[model samples]
Target chain A: MPYLIWALMRDCMPRRWWFGFFAGLLLATVLSFDTNLGAHSLGSYLAYVSVFPLVLLFRCGWVLQQRTSQGWPHQEKLRDSRGYKAPLVEFFGLSTLLLIIYVCASIPCWWNPYPSPPASAGYYPVTIHFGANDYWLFDLHSPVPASSTLLLTLDWSQVQNPEQDVWIQDPNGRKLQAIPGELLRWPLSPAEAKEGKMALHSLPKVGVELRRPLTRLEIPRPGMQQGPHLLLLQFLFFWPLFAMLLAWHRRGKLSGTLSAWTCFALGSLAAMPMQATDLDSGPLALLARAVLLLKLALPPVEGLLAAGARMERLAFTSAATSISGWLVLGALSLWLACKEKRPVQP
Target chain B: MSTATALILDNLVLHRGGKRLLGPLSLNLAAGQKGYLAGGNGAGKTTLMETICGFLPTVEGRIQTATPLGYVPQEPLFPLHLHCQDYLTQLFHLGCNRSMNCTQAVQEALHRFQLAAYGKHPIARLSRGWRQRLNLAQAWLGNPQLLLLDEPQTALDPEGMDCLQAAIQQTTAAVLIVAPEKSGCSKLAPLLGTLSVEAPCLI
Candidate 1:
């Protein structure tokens, strides 16, 4: 009973600690507004258990030493188990309230959530068909200084003659010669195509364009700009966040500082919806502008992937905000663990 | 080992590192008993004291404490953010098992330990000797039935040692000191009713 009473009052008694705790919660809420307790929270809670309790226990033990004749109060309120019960109940009640508030504040982050990407930025595989003398046009919509690589897989099922050839070119009108050895459709029998053994890619990383005739594929050249500067991806979310984190890491100071880097990493993985940003001008650019504004207003959380079904929307920025609690807690764990030995900032 | 005994160790064994540190020992401490915990450096003096305080698990025997136990380890560490006054107030509430006026308790502890000026200071800001003083001051808050001082002289200055002695004299609980030298514990000679270490170590 004495032990139980002692345990209850130790945390409650520390005004500064409670102040720190509440301040942390408020900061996390305003910055992230994320409270879904998931694996990250569990991981962080486990870390909290592993880190802070020991020092608290050690300090409590240090204080509990018997040195003076000053003993427990003789007051009747302290004499029985009844005196400590109210505070214990109050502590439990406070805990529940905190949990509720933590959850309540995070609900807004999910309301009208932004679309997160399905992974790191990369090329998505797709298929296209062409008519006689037909070619494909490739348009890239990017908010950052990003480029794409194309892979051209020939539809061998439509081929009858091995002598058939196609041309390739860039928007600059430079033509790529058709390498005879690069065509694999010549060797495979139609029966092989029937068996699905001949379905193969011609040398890949090709761009498709209809205007250039046979050399229709176009890949973005270096130094290419889709639109005027500051139209997208430059002023906000992606560029600045990435640049700051990268600069910090490069200064040779972030050795074991996993928290800040994790934030950058998670944010980088976040994605925005690309439903209409398929062109450089007109409606696509307008859609891109609106999305840029949306991302600025909202933290673009991944669509609820609670199941693997949501994996497509999981991008870096969304992951960062969604797990911001775990990130902050993890950083706090580091701070507490390193407070005595070294300096750590979350 | 009657139910009224303040502390009892019946065939208690303490094991660490896959080896028995001390064990197959039995002893009883009556209320208000005082004893010197005399043992070699490798002896489980601190371990046994910590076990009695419920900080450790007994590997091989049954032990009992009839009253609330207070313990101070050899080295004291305080969180940087906690204020000395707050520490004392919390100690008072926990010690007395009730939340009453903590001002008096805090003042009394600060005065007793000569820490009145440092009361507002954070625990992290204090020097080592001051930290030990603060640690000793905590023991004076709740009148504990049993006090275990493991190497209480580790970081104490002469004045701090005197403060520790004064604090011990005020307690009615049994105090079992684990000290290396006689001079280190010389002040407690008046209350040092017995000098002993009953636990034997295997390695």
Candidate 2:
């Protein structure tokens, strides 16, 4: 194994690999900085985490293609040396090292001088005060269902009057009146009352029927929201896909490396139709369903990325389908490696 | 499968695209013995070499080897980005010479092939003759028991040809050279026994 790794580093670590590595680092840093400056939400963080590794993996795949085309691991001197096992081990070893480097690059992004806030259930607190005859008309960052509920937390000590009704105005300027329920006030100590402290659970939940899709929301909160740490899972999902593509390229089915890249680009574009919110029974809906099935057949990396960017969890069925898709791709790659019999020509 | 034999072919027939190409011939080479295979154009000399190297599947019969083999195709390709020495070092690590020092093996190969001066040069910049010398260097790097050379004399100058002849004379491995004409085999005639690849009969 040590010799295999040394050989791979000697032969496979071309200048292009180093260029890609530094480029990926720069890209990840920029994306992380952008997320820190922009929404600072879970979706933005997840987007950064998902995208940077993808760029690196694409470059790695290109390097693999170039070396494989030049007859790496299957060169004349290396024939009959433990079959595909050596090459596979070498590739995975280098790829894992790349992932580790990526993680180290991400450590600076995770460093925040101030501690992060408590995890809210995907809710950003609106800082505007609710007063009688004064309406806060703001749009949501994303669309929500008509039956979605809004939570209102108010400190009684800071409230001018606690008996007014709060209404949520939809995009069409129609107001859905909020009926004030029983006062669910928390018993606060003297020090807490002096500090205007209030528990979030004691807040009132108001049912707001959004008549139309809200386009934007103006939340001026300062703290960054923590997203699910999905680096490990993203590595698991994408490494296999990259390996499968490498294996497929090595199989010589597609004419050349350019064709392999084109196929990957087309597959990525096919994942775009999955972002359509309304999939009615039109031709677009048909295309979307076909793409979804294709994603189910392939790695589904872009589908998962889209879902992560939208801060939406995949439906149980979709997640299951994607898992099975990953399994199939992984199995196919292993089968290709094992069934490979022809010597690679120089 | 005698211990002294380096390679054996018994009734070995080869096919390409369901058409019989080369076949039904058998030969054997003992350890340290040099052999030559001669054929005209469209004959199966290269095909047979590829088959023996496991690049092509045999349509009938078997090919057995007593030890690890090294092969040099008629037209070998190199990774253009690698330095000549680095390429040889990688090949040394990949070959069955793991017990030896890699740098020493690579340096020796460069010295033997007169590539010592070109060790730091990228393979892309090398001329055809130099590339052929590099190919020969890699084939003889790990000192495999069986060496398969397919038209290795193609791009060599007379000096390179002399170096090849001297290297072949000094090596203890069993060498099989595929030559397209008698002139290419003339210098090594005393050390090698020649075999001809016959044209396949039309069905």
Candidate 3:
């Protein structure tokens, strides 16, 4: 891919001027994404935003190195050289084998026949009804003892007064009022709270009242924590694919189409099982299985997934500044690639 | 008329930068013949050679050739990393290499140019003599039926000139060169006809 990109821009992007062009692009990306990123962890966002241009920079470095070492190479008139070729069947067979191994690594057959979902295991969803009472209490004793986050989803249409306040009281008798987004989220980190009861209060003193008939409540155990060894093993499941892609990219073989499609597949697999999205299941669920494989295979640890999510939105969204920048770069590259060359003087 | 002619240029007028460069010139070369071209600097000597090699288009004339053409520019440019032998091989490949085995052809070219000792050296590090020899060596590969050289002897030493002259004698192809001095390669001088061109701006 780097070779292709270099070939495309060779005439227009002379070696002497490419560094400045790259610096300008880097500065543009940084400034464009600055407003969307919080200053508290600016480094994380910068790293995320820098990935694409950094990849481009790596390619540019490779191009420069090759040029300095080799000078004007044989213009790869790929249109002419049809002598060396690979059969498509053989390539497809190899790709399929890798994909099968990926699937096997995703399923927890040898580890656990019945694996639980993470969102349900450590968290609870619930609804509460009040009988002209100041507060309603619910007991949750089946939950395994551990710390987790508590979340509340209330039906907005059922509230008679917009000023009404709804709050949750843990077994420690500590209460937290609902914040904005109408979805209350409080940390239920106490070990006792995992096996104890909690209450929902309708505080009329805060001019808050709930005129609802029924509330749906769901409490789950927080005992599904994955061991570090298991997590590492799952992460290494796609080792073969990772190795194959690295080998291909390093070697710089394979046709342009083959290289591009292979990278696309590899990138997509690496990005699946998004940290913030719920895993879906249904018919034709092999897609989900693939995502599950990557989920366990390339687990985003240390909040990397959240950072990636932010980067994805900024780089891919129509409103994002980087999208226009990339489009401009891509168009310029194409124009350079196709432009007619004026014959060189003898 | 010759039984076999390598090239034919009839009343050819060449132009560069929308200005007449050379001729109302006319020339013909029989198969396996050899000659030299002459002109002052900026006199369109290089331009005329390039035009004959089909590197540049003639403003008003026709060029008819019986065999494929090969060109060696005055200042030969090649990839700095290309090995001497690899450069020959690539030349062979470019010629569609129907005549002989690629390795054998490259070896023959290297031996002809006396470059076998420096086969492994990077072209950038090669001296001017070797670079010029390599340039001519590529033109000689796959035995171009007609070879056009533009001021090829400018940087070459006496031994280099002797080697090129000897190679020209050995080849069964029409060889034309642009030379400013009529000296050197004494044995081959009688056969070296001159194609004189004038400066394009003067015209």
Candidate 4:
């Protein structure tokens, strides 16, 4: 397999593709320097997003165009000698290499070598303010573990009635009556509390301390967890579609039905409203549903971004979807390959 | 299917898009034999050759080959972005010549086809005649027992025609070429016979 990949890289990948690879690498590296442009940023999104399509288009499109314009006797020759497996290996091997290169190029965006400020064992001052909804929200710069026992020391010197005026609310917005205590002990549990805005009834100088020393957790960026899966899905989604389209083109069935379907599918994907609620009724909604199912089956970049900070679900769904999509597309491409064994009558 | 016969087509019928096109044809070419398939426009000559190479499924009868086959299609499409030598090298790797050195085999093919000077040149940069030679060179790789060339004389000059004839004559493979009227078939020495596609019978 490595030998085949090496052969394909040396022979199949054109000079322009190499140049594009290097250019994309440079662009990705340059974009990574801007900390503001992280995984979800458009630059990083385009960097990983464009590689699959570009590789697919150049490799498959070139083969299809050449087969259309001039006969592809090499395929026949290879088939005669070694059956059809060689070309299939060549196509997939080269595509995998390109995707690997894309991952390498986008590495800088996901990896940050510099260590952030260490979280020490001390009480950190927290600011408590009333939000627009009249609910008090606490702002903490550091991420607190869900299971930590937090000590919230409130200075009730300004409050006339310390018990009635000042109260702490749990994550669910239910108020917990504050007894006349120097420190309010709140035991955070994964089931009952989350790491988000915690409401307080009174405006006071608040300080929070965990049972253990605050340690900086090395949370992986969203792309680091989901990037490879996204690329794999991209390959699964596009490679077989291109093969099916090329098969249709070769069979002279592309211009009317398949082409229209392709255009409609693409148009529906492009016209998908930013907010999911925008798709409510009519043909657009139906198309949106179809597109949504397609996206679920093969999650696109938007799906990756929508996954956001919660990567576990994304990882699970991505694995399931990638496998399912790979199987379906694999079967479909195999069917097309079998159907295309005989030359179409002109 | 004899040990000495390279290819045998026994009453082979072909179809395209579910419509009957060519055949109920039969022919036998022994190893090292050379022949031409002649026909007018739209006679399914290329289709017949493609079917023989297993590119197209045969509708009826048996098409058997005793040895590995090589095919050169009419208006062959190459990786135009690849250099001539690189393309040949790829073919060598893809071919059944794993025992041989790829560079040496490719170099030999280039020299044989008189494409040695254009080794570094991109296939797209080559002239029509040179491209045709490159196509022939690729087909000759792996030293297959049978070689099928479709309109091998399409873009060849007189000198290119001579080069092709020499290569075909020197090769041990059974050479079956699709030749139009007044093609380089006349120049191909030790010609076995001509198979007319219009009649679907060997003459």
Instruction: Please report the candidate that would top DockQ against the real structure.
Output: 2
What are the lDDT figures for the candidates, one per model? 0.45, 0.58, 0.49, 0.57
Which digits, one per residue and each the tens of the lDDT, describe model 4 over residues A149-189?
44555444555654454456654665544555455665544
Task: Name the 10 consecutive residues with the lowest summed lDDT in model 3 chain A.
Answer: A78-87
- Mark the regions of model 2 whose C-alpha exceeds 4 Å error after superposition: A1-42, A45-52, A73-78, A112-228, A251-288, A296-309, A312-332, A342-346, B16-18, B189-203
What lDDT tens digits, residue by residue, belong to model 1 across residues A273-327?
Answer: 4333334788878886865665544343332111121221121213335445333
What iRMS does model 2 reach?
5.4
The clash count for each model shown is: 28, 2, 5, 0
Interface RMSD of each: 15.3, 5.4, 9.5, 6.2
As for candidate 2, its clashing pairs are A139-A216, A140-A216
Sorted by lDDT (best first), the order is: 2, 4, 3, 1
Report DockQ per prediction, comma-separated. 0.03, 0.28, 0.07, 0.19
Going through the candidates in order, what fraction of the true interface contacts does each contain?
0.00, 0.29, 0.06, 0.19
Highest TM-score against the true fold, candidate = 2
On residues B42-134, what C-alpha lDDT tens digit does candidate 2 reach at each position? 677788887887767666878887456777778787888888998887676555455777888889889988999999999999999999999
Tell me which residue pairs clash in candidate 3.
A126-A217, A127-A215, A127-A216, A164-A208, A165-A208
Regions of candidate 1 where Cα sits further than 4 Å from its true position: A1-346, B1-4, B91-96, B189-203
Estimate the TM-score for candidate 1: 0.43
